[model samples]
Target: MSEQSLFERIGGREAVEAVVGSFYEAVAGEMSLRVLYPEDLTPSREKLEYFFEQWLGGEPRYSERYGHPRLRRRHFPFVIAEHHAQLWLKHMRSALELQQIEREDFDSIWGRLESLANHMVNAHEEVPREPLPEDAWLT
Candidate 1:
């Protein structure tokens, strides 16, 4: 017989939803991450719920509803530098801890997500622009 999916091992749909919700809550606290999302995070939260559900091997709700994930392609618009990816993982790690999952299960999930976060980096950070010498500024 096949091994149980991470979804099942972690207690299925409700667990996934809880973890996703926690992840978003953590993400909300960070201004750097918060800037990437819309003011209203309801839609974003739902999308992540559906995505984590399928990604953890529960069901294909996300793909069925939104077509192929195209995760990297979809995230291309954002300038995801190394630090951004690390912050994303930090929030995700906190969310996973809130679930109190087993070590192996955590490893399985964490490994995949870490890879995904790193992969999402589409650009590097450039130096900040200098301010004009004059405070008066141009019209």
Candidate 2:
């Protein structure tokens, strides 16, 4: 390839793998996010690594293995609220920093990811979470 892909710019598979690893490490402890993941993170880790590898321009392996990545559709089963997206991005930023991805390069990647995360927000806008008198807890 003439131009170096973002994958290459961030130091290819090894670096991407490390970043993804760091991401899950953070997620593993984050209860809000943790509840959303399976008890076994291995599959999630593998799938994400493959997807990122291809998305960042190393190989077509993710698509090859998983077919079309219907990301939103895949995520449809989850009740992804706004807070969840923010938490996801927060960990993503930490992961990128942990891997020491260059600011400029990471910025580009971060922007796209932010949009993607926001797009995954399936919940409605914030509303008062009050309960009706009958529904309120009996104190």
Candidate 3:
């Protein structure tokens, strides 16, 4: 239900953070998505952790600290394409699967993640830029 908080459904901040950390770990090693993350994912992880905390219906820390998510605006500088989206989703799915979250809960979380990933795309060009090798692998 929309009224229910994400923290409650996902097992609170600790659980969400664990899932995110797992996802990032996979992302860091993934050649296609390694560059998507910054040199340090600590802040990024914290932000998402807080955002999801509010998004699932708990507190509104994300909006309170950052104002409108403006996700697209924030990701405009990145060269996200179909390949990148697919790869990112792969890692996320893997992480969720590893977490062994309930099927229904996994679906809900994956649906939102899919929408957000799709929304982050900024380029449709045939020849998209490549991520730096060092940056491409999160590891």
TM-score of each: 0.84, 0.86, 0.79
By TM-score, how accurate is candidate 3? Answer: 0.79
lDDT of 3: 0.73
Most lDDT-accurate candidate: 2
For model 2, the run of ten residues with the poorest summed lDDT? 130-139
lDDT of 3 by residue, 12-96 (tens): 7777788789987887788767776788878777877777788777787877777776666556557888888888888878776
Give a tens-digit lDDT track for model 1, residues 1-139: 9998888888888888887788889888999989987788888888888888899888888887777787776676567789999999998888888886899989989999999999888786443233222111122
Candidate numbers sorted by lDDT from highest down: 2, 1, 3
Model 1 alpha-carbon drift over 4 Å, by segment: 1-3, 125-139
Which runs in model 2 stand beyond 4 Å of their true positions?
125-139
Error of 1 at 115 (Å): 0.7
| Candidate 3 ranges with C-alpha deviation above 4 Å | 1-4, 125-139
Global lDDT of each candidate: 0.80, 0.82, 0.73
- Judge candidate 3 at residue 35 and give its lDDT: 72
**Candidate 2: RMSD over Cα atoms?**
10.1
In the order shown, what is each candidate's alpha-carbon RMSD? Answer: 9.9, 10.1, 6.6
